[model samples]
Target chain A: MIRLKVALAMAAGIAAISSAPAFAAKAKSEEKADAAPIAIPAPPPGKGQIVFFRPGGMGFALGCSVNENGEKISSLGAGRYFILVTEPGTHQYSVKSEAKDTLGLLVESDETQFAKCKIKMGIVAGRPDIQPATEEEFRKQKSLKLVDEDDMGPAPGALRPAEIAAALAQAPAAE
Target chain B: MLAIFVATILSAAAVEAAAPESDGVSSADATEMVLSASLPEGGKAPLSDDPESARRDITIPKLTPISIQILKPLGSKLSKTGETFPIRLAAPILVNGVEAVPAGTEGMGEVIHAKKSGGMGAAGELVVTARYLDVDGRQLPLRSLHWAQSGQSRVDTVNTLNVASAASPLPIGLVGFFIGGGQINVAEGALADAKTAADFSIALPQVSSQQAGTGQELSEGDLAVPSGAVPDEAVDTESAAADVHQGGKE
Candidate 1:
């Protein structure tokens, strides 16, 4: 009887040990589901838009601040995105730290574009690089959130949280 | 044909305006004047008058596949992000039985990301993109050339060796943790494929413009309209604030 009891106890302990990781994974997925997804709206007529996002990775503490001609546009944190509305023309976007990387894009009217910022190993620190991204790539990142207003630059292009909400409201409801 | 020709001229004009030393208006005006002089009203554009101005438009449709050959060797440990390399067309772009862009035309490629192998069995990574082709002093943008590669990861092998060592009579505890991954490398003359980003109408000289149709004169309407649109100012702050509060609740 003692031998049978010991076997059952060992089996129970094994099951608990295996199930703990599954339970933790389930809890993490549940927590992810709890965060509401932010909505993106179309650019107002005659204007172009760019969605700048930085996915969470090795350099989570680094700030990916986007700039235009040396003027700050927004601080793109890890796992965060911001919308910048601008005139339809060729615009140059840049990010810098120990080094600077620039991406030139031809923003078109009534078109939505995406730029991805990645942190790579630099000589002294992590360097942020911006590259053109597609909409499919943008949708693949599920943990994106709107940037806080305090992180925005003094520039007049980036949409604030309030502006994004209003734009979403004004956008005709998706069929 | 006329619409595409006008658009190409305007595109060239835009490139001129974007130059650092350009005042934006004079160069564009000069381009317009040159275009107007070459194309008289109600007359077919002089297709073969001067070798320089004898170029005719040939529309390279969007998404046309292009093969390019890298001119130099590149490696994750040896390359840096944003570095540019010389590249050449590996094959001629045939449009309607004629070579539009020849095989020897040179272009530029950019390194998007390069990370050398690190300690703890981390692998090296490299990514590159085909930026553009200089087709007769005009920049023909290319896209979809995103190529990524990773070095052979030593993690699995190191783990197995470490486990075997730890199980030995004289155990070496986790010695594999000091090992590093391989460095990724791409040899010179490597072939890559990319596609035209958009519908680009390139000017081919009349000698090779047998299939090209007659070009049209540049018109005032053909000029690119200056982008004057500003951001929308109207915002429903109250509703947005409420929505933000609701999001917080979530």
Candidate 2:
């Protein structure tokens, strides 16, 4: 009982430390002292809307850019956003998480069997290193006899290390 | 390709931000920046081309030389077997080069009692949870909790500057793994000292004899110990050399 009380007390103290006015003051002062020159994300162009899928946990949305057709894409907008560049054609998208990483997508017009993927984790098929799966890659995996993602929660007691990869995705781009 | 490129950032430490010859920003801005500024993707992700990403990556080059060590428990409290040696330790954690984790912040490594070894074969069994700092001095939560940004204005920015601007970091937590017959080769209590090997030791936490109130086992539903901690044996320096050497092999 005492240990529990102590643990609880410590937790409360940490909570107080996180919110106390004095601590806040110190953190604020420290923030000023520690401030470094940073590059704020360039503002969004009037044309495209950047999107965000909630990071981790029950919330999962990358919050990519919205295309003219109201399709979600990741582009132009800055701020730790993913994706290199998408095709010019209109694209519809959703997310397929393999392990943990997430991404955005661009599709080739009218070619739907499996065109491209934009996610954080997926199998590369013949490729060994794990990558994110885009819609296209999903199709490719389907085509190549790879297992489909369960889309369900992990089994009870599974070791969740944090979690994934992929396409319309060669890598990070520089402007 | 880019994924591999980023993962390739296995090495390379960002020089720390120098402490202010001046102090100005308030914690609000600091919290806002820390919370809002976009964190480059990936907890272990690489530093991006963005200066902000680079600035965030600024760390005292760690994750190297800090090899994880697994030590076997002493055969019996009264007597023992094995060699003990000194292993270099990464600096005790610092948030912006400041030491914050007070003494006893670390309760020794987890203790495994009775039942035969659970570690590598033959090696007696015990689990070692080496505390480390990978998450920019800040300890990210283990359990997921809602960090509502709705009320908080978010500002995600990274600042890259010459070596002078990077700040030191804090020691994060440790991960536990089962290893038997091995002895940790670190300095005692992870005391801060001149980077000398003498400042090392491995001590595991002691489990109370009365049994943990929660009725939980050591591993998930395995064995149970009391709620409070057990007192560790008087560290034996007499066996230090042999312990270090044997601990290295076993």
Candidate 3:
């Protein structure tokens, strides 16, 4: 009877040892499956879509303001993306920090453009660099989250209603 | 016996605790795993549409010097330091002897330095840098440097003509000289348009897998041949000789 009891206990221990890894793996996988889904917005008809995304960054908490034609679009954080839909034409994109770096993009109608933002060491803090990104490059960044509305900063030097109307009036017509 | 059984149970518990956890999974998979369980059964989240396939009509040449032209002329009046401007290829850029960037394909240039004409015969100065070549919908950041001067040469030529006219007997000579000087003033735009002073020869990196067994493995100190060596027809004798010397050393 003593021998039988010992055997049962040993068998129970072996079973527990064998099953632990499997349980742990399942739990981890379950944790991952619980992450929130990202929603990507579609480009409006006859307009182009520009996605400004920052992938991996050493300074994860650092952020910089992005401006389009001198109007502040959003403050982009690390591992985040912002989307802008505009009429296809020439657009000046700039990232503002200790100094500003600018890129001239000729947006084509009905096309999607991807720009990657990176942070570099600056005199005061990190400066942002925006560059054209290939589709494959953008897709490979798996952790890129969409910037939420609350996280977006208000447009700098907030334009009055008339100024906003004038600016929109001057903008090219969307197809 | 009970003591042995207890020891066995403890050993098993230790082994279970020591087993490695799943820590190295890709972020994409992890994200999918987190969201997938909440998704309705058999329903899938949408992915961003893939970019349009690169136009296959244009073939990439192996290695060739790309010739570009300044479309929008840079001068003291129009360009300021750190200002960006547009440019175009004067001729189609060939890669491996094939057309890569067609003529008139838009490119970007920057004025690194610019100064308007100061008093005391001080000529205007301008230094321009090429930024990128927009090739077939791709903006390839330039890895090479190209610079050109305009105002100084025009200034020198004007001074030479003025001195020559002053020494001449005819009044018509002075009038002609002034007109020529005016032409020189306009020459800033013309020089950039007419002169073929800038050429970019880029070296394409050899794919590591393709380089296997080629005896072309290069170390940090080894200077490899420029992939975009100008064709023999295009290179002068001196340049060809230099290439030969470099090749021999390699």
By lDDT, the better pick of 2 and 3 is: 3
lDDT of 1 by residue, B1-250 (tens): 9999999999999897566345544444444433333344452333444554433455788778999998889998999977999989899987755578999899999887777876445467677777788898987888766465557655555546655775897544355557777888888999998888777776554332233222333211121111211112221223323322332232
lDDT of 2 by residue, B140-212 (tens): 1111010101111011111111111234242111101122222223224332222111122222122232321
In terms of lDDT, the poorest run of 10 residues in model 1 chain B is B223-232
The CAPRI-style docking tier of model 1 reads incorrect
Query: What's the TM-score of every candidate structure?
Result: 0.43, 0.15, 0.34
Question: Second chain TM-score per prediction?
Answer: 0.60, 0.18, 0.38
Identify the leading candidate in terms of TM-score.
1
Ranking by lDDT: 1, 3, 2
DockQ of 1: 0.04
Off by over 4 Å in 2: A1-175, B1-90, B102-106, B112-123, B130-250
Candidate 1 share of real interface contacts? 0.00
lDDT of 3 by residue, B52-164 (tens): 21111323432234555666666655677678877666676654343445687777877655545432233344556556777546665542232423243223343344456
lDDT tens digits by residue: candidate 2, A11-90: 99998877798877988887765443211121122112122221221112332222323333332111222222223222
Best by DockQ: 1
TM-score ranking, high to low = 1, 3, 2
DockQ of each: 0.04, 0.01, 0.01
Interface RMSD, one decimal, each candidate: 8.1, 20.5, 17.4
Docking class of 3: incorrect
